[model samples]
Every structure is written in structure tokens, then in C-alpha cells.
Target: FQVKKKQFFRNFMTITLFGAVGTMMSFFTISLAAIAIFSRMNIGTLDVSDFLAIGAIFSATDSVCTLQVLNQDETPFLYSLVFGEGVVNDATSVVLFNALQNFDPNQIDAIVILKFLGNFCYLFVSSTFLGVFTGLLSAYVIKKLYIGRHSTDREVALVMLMAYLSYMLAELLDLSGILTVFFCGIVMSHYTWHNVTESSRVTTKHAFATLSFIAETFLFLYVGMDALDIEKWKFAS
Candidate 1:
């Protein structure tokens, strides 16, 4: 138990920290290119706010997608590690954006630095420790539950409720909702549940994941077309 807990923490930290650095690198390059090619101006004159919104929108790699792949029977540690880091970076980006909008950068000086560091320390420790303990408790109840395996469909409902509701509840408490969901996932994975009537859990995971990818693709395509048209008009004018 202790080993697993330690591994989980270590896994969370490495992926979250390194993943953020990598994301910034990609984002920085793309932002520069967008300014150079789109605006026909030097990067030095570009406003940071323009690119910042898009960065925030796509900043975090979707954890569901990564886990969707890793939950498979033959997934590797590298996959999990990358997925974990992506999740962490996404969280960091959102939190960072919130802070940016709420406070002034100039105010981030000495005393402010101490508060910032202290707040993060509190959030990380409290969220992780509490999230895991909550998950473990839920697992204990679920493992003992006999929810009438008579209907696999019903069992899947329970899984969805557990995942979604727990996440929402965690957020209302001002904790890391994603971490809570991930912890719940790990806990739920350890228990026995009715097989999904439509298909296996892996299949369900994949189906939803594929749907998300499709939606993201078409949505981005439409948005890109509109943006390009607007850009061309602006250039022509």
C-alpha cells in the first residue's frame, strides 16, 4: 500500500512538472510562427494576450485520451507516464491562467512569492492526500457492493456516476477535481463490477474516446476555416 502510494505521488510529480515545460516549448514555437506568418510582423510587436487564450484552450493534453489508450491490456509505463504528465500540465495551465487574470504580475514580488509558493504547497498536498483517502474509502464500499450484477448496463451507470459525481464534489470543495477522478479510477479498477452489457469496459472507454476525437476534429476544422477567411479579409483590406 505504501509503495503504491509513493509510486502514485512520484508518477504525478514527474509527469506534471516535465509535461508543462514541454507544452510551453511547443506553444512558444507555434505562437511565434502564428505572429510571423499571420500578422506579417515581427514577434517583438505581438501582444501576449492574443496567443494566450488559444494556449489556455489547448494547453492541457486530455487525460481521458491518454488513459483511454493505457487502460488497454497491453499498454506500457511510458504511456502512463506521458498521460500523467499531460494531465498535470493541463491543471497547472488552468490554475496559472486563473492566477494571471486575478492578480498583477508586478505584485508577484517577494512577499507575494511566499504566498504563491505557500498556496501551491497547500493545494498539492491537501488535494493529493485527501483525494486518495476519499478514493480508498469509496473503493471499500464499492467492492462490498453487490449491486445486482443482473444488468451490466446498470453496472456501467454506477461507474459513470462514481467517476463524474466524485469529480464534481471534489471541485465544490476547492480541491483538484481531476486528481480526485483519477484516484477514483484507480480505486474502481481494483474492484469487481458487472460486465458492461453493450461491451467490455475497455470498449466503452475507447468508444467515448473516439467520439471525443471526432468532435474535436470537426470543431477545430470549422473554427480554422472561419479564422483563415477573416485573416485573408484583413490582409486584403
Candidate 2:
């Protein structure tokens, strides 16, 4: 809720690095370890590629759980780190997952590793730029059109529309929509928020908080229900 906290925001760089590099390392480590363990245990026939796929799935972390548990009053560093890492990790894992989706076991070599890393960096940078660009563009339009002077309802709609449009545009272009939306939010907060109508500014803030809470609640509930689904348990084995 308190985005103005400098101390909390200072952990952004550390969290970004952890989410990007740390996630990739963890994916590899977990996949290799899982393969070793599964092979030893003679579990169902799952090879290294399968483990990698599974690792990719678990690499992305959601900050909703962490944020819900740790209030703003608690350790700011931990909260910021968790939030930042969650954002970065989601973007990283999406790129990593897509990169490894069609991976060939026979082509696993030094060159493949280098290529993967190169592609990952490119994807991350491009996707980030897409989000920032969209956000800036939206902000510019609002400022130029004096959207804030308009009705508060119209301002709210414009803001939400720009945000969702950025996401859809990124996905349409075969880019990372998650990263695009994340960066779009950043741009909106930094630029567009100020350009919005004064009345709508407060409305937008509460709207975001409420929507985020509802989405997070439903997400966790869905996960919990899925976990308890006896019918789907057989698929795991």
C-alpha cells in the first residue's frame, strides 16, 4: 500500500537480480536434483527434460501469499524483496519456460547454454522495454488530452484501458504480457497517476487495491481446491 517508502523500494535492484539470475540457477539445480532423486527412486519414467519442465513451473513465485502474510509494518526489506522478486521471477520463468519447451536432450551442450542465456537476456530486455514504452505512451496521451480534467469515471476507464491494452498488445506481439503489465503499472504509478484527475487518483488507488485482493484471494482458493481434488490426485502419480 505504501509505495512511497524509500527504504523498501531500495531493495528493488537486489530483488531483480535474485529473480532473474537466482531463478535460472534454481531451475537448473532443481531439475538436476529432481532427476537424480527420481532416477534413484525408480519413479515413473520422467527424464531430465521432464524435470526441467516441472522445475520451470515451480520457478515462478507469486508475491500475493507473502504480502498477505507480511504486513507493511513488518520488515520492509523482506517485504520489498519478496514483492520485487515475485515480479521479476514471473517474467524470468515465463521466458525460461518458453525457451526450454522444445528443448532437445541431445543438444544440451556449452553452446546451448550460452545461447539460452543470450536469448533469455534479449527476451527480458525487449519485454521490459515494451512495458515501459506502453506506459509512457499512455501517460503521454492522458497528459496531452487533459484526461485528468475529464470526469473521474472516464479517467478511471482510460487508465484501466491503457493498462490492459498494454498487456494485450505485448501478448499479441508474442512478448511477455506479465512483464509488460508489471512495467506498465510501474509507469502508470510514476507518470500516469499524477496526470489523472485528482478525484480519480484516490478512486484508482482503492480500485487497484481491491482488485488485487480479490484476484489474490480467488487464486489461492483455486490452488487450495485443486490440491484437495481427489480425482486429480491420480494424475500426479
Highest TM-score scorer: 2
TM of each candidate vs. truth: 0.58, 0.89
Q: Which stretches of candidate 2 lie over 4 Å from their true place?
A: 5-9, 146-148, 234-237
Going through the candidates in order, what is the number of backbone clashes in each?
A: 1, 0
Model 1 clash pairs are 15-85
Worst 10 residues of 1 by lDDT: 1-10
**Model 1 ranges off by over 4 Å:** 1-17, 20-78, 129-134, 146-150, 191-237
Q: Model 1's lDDT to the true fold?
A: 0.57
